[model samples]
Target: MPTKTLRIPTTDGPADAFAAFPDDGKRHPGVLMYSDAFGRRPVLERMATELAGHGYYVLLPNLYHRHGPAPVTELPEYIGEEVRPAVLARLMPVLEAHTADRVLSDADAYLGFLTAQPEVCAGPVAVTGYCIGTLYALNTAAARPDAVAAVAGFHPGFVVTDAPDSPHRLIPGLAAEVHLGIAEGDVTPEIIGELTRALDAVGLGHTCEVYPGTVHGFTMADTDAFSAAGLKIHWDRLLSLLDRALARD
Candidate 1:
């Protein structure tokens, strides 16, 4: 696989991103990969490379570009109890600033850039995200039903929030396969049930599962809650969803 650093022109500003794809010189399906609130870092780069190894052209953008370029703030090598609060303090404002409107705008630019790449095949693409990135992933899929074929969100925060513009509210617009991996400790059973009901109401093909005993950020190798077993489960579900959504084309 080969990886490259790239920039995308967005309505708000130029967004920095990373791309990884197979070296075969053959065009592959495009996939928009969103990074967690921690922003783009080594872990995200590794994940993008891993996805590209599966034969898709993976694009990982710096979602917090509105505030600053990635590594927006220095992330600790490891996110333990003592360092978690400080990191969140610096990250909260950027996360809050990523309103639905901003996400939709970036989505347009991102999807456009990905599809235009020489290594990407034509047709609908897929979107996948982790943690806070999951909200944007869901919104992007809904906003571009014609171009996004599937969406997968893992350990997402604010999925069941009371906010008027919560990502779950856009489910009706999604014309894609959806998969959600909820951390057991992130939300109550009732919340998950309500989200599932919303998905059903929209007639979207989807699956929602709770990864047992895992807390938020279970798939992030740098987090204290990281679970190797749970991460494996997440990868299995994500790759399966991508294969069904992008591989066919």
Candidate 2:
């Protein structure tokens, strides 16, 4: 895989990002991968490369570029349960500051930049997210239904909310096939049913299921909540969703 550090021009400023793609010199499908609340890091880069190796152009951007580059706040190498609370204490303000308007702005810039890359083939792309990025991914897919063919999220957070503009409410606008691999207890059965109903109302192909024996952030290897088995299930569902949605005639 060939990876390059790049900057995406957003309404706020230039957001630091990176792209991973095959070295075969042929254009490939594009995937916009949103990092978890921890933001971009080695693990995310590795994930992007792994997805790239499967024959797609993967772009990972720093969600907190407005505050500064990735790791906007210093992070411990291993986020054990004891250290996670402290980390969240420091990050909550930053995460909360990223309002819906900012998300929409960044989504436009990110999608525009991804599709414009020479190595990315023309047509709709896929968006995948982890943790809090799930909200972002859903927002992006809803905002750009025509530009996105697939949307997948792992251990998602804040996607189903009571707010009038909650992500679930936006499902009617989405054209992408959707799959959500939830960590056990990360979401309530009631909310999951609500999300399913919204997706069904829109008549789109979708699934929202909780991964057995996993907790929030189960797909992140650097987190104490990481579950190897859960991660495997995530990749399986994610790849298949992408394959079915992005397949060309």
Decoy 2 TM-score against native: 0.98
Q: Which ten residues in a row have the lowest lDDT in candidate 1?
A: 240-249
Inter-residue clash pairs, candidate 1: none
lDDT of 1 by residue, 177-217 (tens): 99999898787888888889998998887999999889899
Instruction: List TM-score per model, in order.
Output: 0.96, 0.98
Model 2 C-alpha lDDT per residue in residues 1-249, reported as the tens digit of each score: 899999999989999998999999899899999999989999899999999999999999999999998889989988899899899899999999999899999999999999999988889999999988999999999999989999999998888888999889999999999999998898899999999999999899999989999999998999988899998999899889988888532
Estimate every model's Cα lDDT from 0 to 1: 0.90, 0.92
Q: Where is the poorest 10-residue window by lDDT in model 2? A: 240-249
Q: What local lDDT score does residue 166 receive in model 1, on the 0 to 100 scale?
A: 83
The clash count for each model shown is: 0, 0
